[model samples]
Target: MKKTIGRKEKPYMLPYFQMEEDSFVITTWHDGQGFNLYTSNERYKTLERLISRLPKGTIIEND
Candidate 1:
């Protein structure tokens, strides 16, 4: 799936990730919560893999 960086409904928690082209960006949410804790290269890789496995258009209700 294409990695589009943007808000996830919250503001405090920013979910940052890179797209297939390695373009990095940070996304939070409209509610303002749930930011990404992974900063290291390894952690980001792990997150990328995990998120990639999720089904397309999977909505994360929690912020």
Candidate 2:
């Protein structure tokens, strides 16, 4: 009897951002005194840049 090898499934990547809305405001601070507004596309790019700058093994909390 020959044994068949099964293909391994790809590991699932945990979602760091919930980008469902049409527009996204990247960040705001000091009661809207200071803010950085970005479009949906820009938001994604900014997030990617921020993530890349972080040190390895950095765990992001999504609460």
Best by TM-score: 2
Q: Which residue pairs overlap in candidate 2's backbone?
A: none
What digit string (tens of lDDT, one per residue) describes model 1 on residues 1-63?
334477345435445555454344445646765444434444356755656666999655533
Which lDDT value does model 2 have at 56? 100
List the global CA lDDT of all models: 0.52, 0.57
Please, what is the TM-score per model? 0.25, 0.26
True lDDT of residue 19, candidate 2:
60
Candidate 2 lDDT over residue span 1-63, tens digit each: 333356555555542555666565556767955445455554346656656666999775533
Where does the lowest 10-residue lDDT sum fall in candidate 2? 1-10
lDDT, model 2, position 12: 59
Cα lDDT, model 1, residue 4: 40
List runs of model 1 lying over 4 Å from the truth: 1-22, 35-43, 48-63
